[model samples]
Target: MADLFDNINDWLMQEALDENPLTSIVETFGRRLVEGGVPVARISIGRSILHPTIGLLDVQWEQDTGQVNTQAVPRQIVRNSLEIFDTPFGELSKGKTDRLFADLRDPDEVARFPMFEQLAARGMTYYAAFSRSFGRTHHLYERISNEFRGASLSFTTKRFSGFSQADLDGLERVLPAFCICLRMDIERFVAGEILETYLGKISGKQVLDGQVERGDGQEIDCAILYSDLRGSVTLSQTLDSTAYLDTVNAYFDCVATAIDEHGGEVLKFIGDGVLAIFPFDEANRPRANMCAAALSSAQEAFARAEHANRGRSGDGLPALHFGVGLHVGTVIYGNVGTARRLDFTATGPAVGLASRCEGMTRELDTPLVATGAFAEHCPRAGADLGQHRLRGFADPIALVSYPLT
Candidate 1:
């Protein structure tokens, strides 16, 4: 336990201080408590969580009142912790004691967690948890919980051996260091929010550490937008390698610029094409972000293409254009590939749909086209182009997109 606390303090000073400090501080503490033998812990930024889009979540973790469940008196109730969208899900797991892989052999589980009967098959029993808050955005909540079977020091054996009390005291001593870094996180979150709102977005890249908080460098549901320079292939064939790269880079500049303008993160570029993400945020859904960004990027790309073609004195050639596609649904969004090397790209059904949309941009004589889902939520969804029966999908989807404005 002493070693674990020392590690937490060191991480608090190091990893906790980053572009977004509050989130790092909370995660640091939550994970440390898990390793501390508390088995289970949680940080409640407020008594519960209250937000508009949380309709799908209804669980004990959501802070409804400052009363702190005086109605229940949870095993280890700490107040004013971090606020997260997934809090209810984790709390349900712990409160219901459904996650214990060790407590299955114990009889207490039958009375305490009838729902966790499957847990005993896996060998688990009861769990312990701790929670607290930090940072100016005291809304930040973090929790740590773990389980037990009939293993280790039982409740009856604790009186005969004094090690349990000693261990808890050691954990208490280590908690203060985490508190220090949490203070810094609070300051940074407030300062950064104020600065950005006042000065405007300082960096061209999108800011998304908040949305990806739970992604431990792995894949998730995200809208991926791919934009390719249609005429670049022909242009590159005529130019030297250096000139080709310069031309491609110029097109990349335009695509990336539009993506950032509409709150999308550029993940990578494939030669003349660029891949980016319209990640879900506190305000908007994933479907909305994807269509808005695709429409914006297409307009931006076409404008630049026309301007460049005119500047080049294209006496007989058609103005350059881009084929763009957007599809919404689950796609892997983490670092996946070789163990030594990986790329944070989404794959699966949605990506294929996006590819089909891009193909339609060329066939339909339009710069922007998206799958059916985009029309459902996009703020600027204009008209339906018609239904498309993609090669693999079981049902034909209604393709929709906006005319470049």
Candidate 2:
């Protein structure tokens, strides 16, 4: 048993440096315990995570199938659920107990927790749960308590005699090392989630792939879509701060959702405006496909805003009005800004032109406008609004308007 634990510790140390995913680590650890004669039928590990959408991460490994399953509990669900307090893991996390052991075969002991009864019904005879702290807490810790403070590990067995003293002692001795490995992987995961949240998916991956230096970028041809909310200044002046923020978020949800669904990346939100792109890849995504996707996204954004406006009107709130512009051109996409504060985004004349096209929507009294470069790709031609000299550009550019149906 001592030698088995030593091997597990050595493997865990290497894994800490390798930073493999937490799921794979937990699955292998459970298998190792079973091979060492621990008779573990199931192992579950739960820990709080710092994510915009997810509050908790749960990983379960079952010896019967030698498979691991993972679940990401949403922040709202975790906040409202009282069921956590009824489990042994909940008791350990609350600091009411450091460890829990139950003889599942004993009716009285099985009745101690709802989980014990479930495990006994599944033919498990004994169960043990342990808590390990990562020694760090954040704002979420105040709301969820010890749940956000660290991790909880539970092991269940079908063995008639349950886990012996030696098995429990071995686990107690090895748990710290295992937790250290898990923390390493978790930190990496959190970093990625934050980056992806702040930066678009493509840009975030580039940063993670070691493209962190300022001015590190690549020139690429893509279709750019820019949309701005109309009368935002007046809305801001009339509405309170909270109400104005909610309104802006609602507008963003409409535009961003449409862009994402049409295979575009929302690069940034500049006040009331959104800048997004659908890259043109000759191998995977053709130029026409990207341009069409950008146009479709603009149409969908208008449709979503119209639906939202109907609800707002019923509630005696102002309707939402927005304009979208589409253009296709080459732009530099990558990191920019100060050494300390970098922003991953797209920049160039094409991006400027796309914004200008959106600005033209107000003058033309249209909801959607596209440059000739973008309109050329559409199967159905748009009504040409004639060549007009746009601001910042000396040459007159041809523009077209699409009918949002």
Candidate 3:
């Protein structure tokens, strides 16, 4: 048993060095333990994560199927529920216990947790849970206790005799090494989630691929979509801070959802405005496809706003309104900013033109406006609004109102 544990530890170290994915690591670890005569029937690992939408990441492996399954618990549920504290893993995580061991066959022990009852029903005889701290504080887990900064791992066995002293000892000895590998993979996963949450997916990948230098960027032709909430300044002055923020978020949800659904990436939110792009790909997606996608996204945004307005009006709140500008041109996409604080975004004359077109929304009294460059690729009929002088450009640019009304 001691030799088996030593071999497992060595294998974990190599897996950590290779940066193996957490799912694959957990699956293999469960199999190895079973093969080493530990008789582990099920293994579960749960970690608190930093993310906009997800609060907990759980990975479970079953010996029967030799497969691993992962689940992302929503932040809202994690914040609001007390169920997490009711389990054995929760006790270990809160530092109330160093480890847990229970015989599912014992009615008294099975009564301790609802999970034990289910495990017994599934033919699991014994259960054990242990926690490994990541050696750092997590804001989300602070309320649960600052000590719960890492992962909770649990193992169950279906053996009639349950886990013997040797099995428990071997598992305990190898756990630390396995957890070290898990931490490495979890940190990598968190970094990706955070970067993708703040920056668009494309930009996040670029940064991960080592596009860190300040001037590292490339000019790419794409369709730019700019959308801004109307009367935001007046709304800010009239509404309370919380109400104003809620309104802004609602508007953003509408715009961002539409853009994402139409294969566009929202780059940033400038106050009450959104900047997004649909990059043209010669192989899979062409320029016309990108332009059409941008146009469809703009129309979808307006539809979503209208739907939201119905609920707002029913509640006696003012209806929401916003404008979108669509254009296609080349822009530099990459890292830009001060030496220490950098932003991954798109910038160039094309971006400026898109913003200017959005500004024309107010003048033209239209919800959606497109530059001639964008209109050319869109098959949908649009009402030509002839040449109009924009703020930045020296010459007047032609604009069109989409949907032909």
- Provide backbone clash counts, one per model: 49, 0, 0
Ranking by lDDT: 3, 2, 1
TM-score of each: 0.45, 0.96, 0.94
Span of 10 residues, lowest total lDDT, candidate 3: 138-147
TM-score of 2: 0.96
- TM-score winner, 2 or 3: 2
TM-score of structure candidate 3: 0.94
Per-residue alpha-carbon lDDT of candidate 2 for residues 186-210, written as tens digits (9 for 90 to 100): 7888888888778877777889999
Better of 1 and 2 by TM-score: 2
Better of 1 and 3 by TM-score: 3
Ranking, TM-score, top scorer first = 2, 3, 1
Residue-wise lDDT of candidate 3 within 218-250, one digit each (tens)?
Answer: 999899999999999999999999989999999
